[model samples]
Target: MQHKHGISPRMEHYSCMVTLLGRAGKLDDAYDIINQMPFEPDGCIWGSLLGSCRVHGNVVLAEPENASNYVLLSNIYAYKKMWDGVNRLRDMMKTVGLKKEKGCSWIEIKNKVHMLLAGDSSNPMMAAITEKQ
Candidate 1:
């Protein structure tokens, strides 16, 4: 698009390109495109690569600080029932002093806001909530 129409490519376009190349097993080429992007890539870009890596059994992560990246990889390993990989990632996090913070959600009802943390069962209405779900 840039060369033919003078229009810069957006993140979504790059994402699609990466996904396409990744699905075709052109991981290196997909990574090359990410590197060439003028703007810094966000989670979506890395996510595209990570997904391809999972499918291809290759882990190529350029980011180190984001906890979410680790979580994503861990989730992939868990999905595949690769217990060893999951444990290794957990150990790596401990060694690196990285902790995955608990995720939370906020909901408002009757003008009152309530915060709920992931895996939290302290709420008195937890049983009802689970039953509702």
Candidate 2:
């Protein structure tokens, strides 16, 4: 359709196609799109591919073939319970000095938001929140 209309496909459009292909178990086609895209594939694109690989147990592109896409791709694999993928990603991270960013959360209350970090439980009612959960 894009070629028919002489319209250049946007990054988002390409990403969406990749996502759809992944969802449909057309991982080979998804990988082809990533490899053939005119623009560089971003983390989202690689992440989508990684997710498909995990679901299908296809390790063709499971390795960090492209370093730039490693971070998100590794994460997607990890989320899918691929320990080997996680280890590979960790090794790549060590090689590139890329530490996983520590997770943090923000809570919005009364038009004001409070940021909470992993170990910094500065919330006044931390005990109450834990009890409820």
Q: Which digits, one per residue and each the tens of the lDDT, describe model 1 over residues 1-133?
A: 8999998899999999999998898989999999999899887788788878777766555233467668768776787788897898888898888887787777665676667789998976556555653
Least accurate 10 contiguous residues by lDDT in model 1: 57-66
lDDT of each: 0.78, 0.74
Over all chains combined, what TM-score does candidate 2 have? Answer: 0.56
What's the distance in Å from true for residue 78, model 2? Answer: 7.9
Name the regions of candidate 1 deviating beyond 4 angstroms: 60-65, 75-84, 94-133
- For model 2, residues 13-114, the per-residue Cα lDDT tens digits are 889999899989999898899889998988678767876776776666665545534655666566678789778777977887866555577776567777
TM-score against native, each model: 0.59, 0.56
Q: Which candidate wins on lDDT?
A: 1
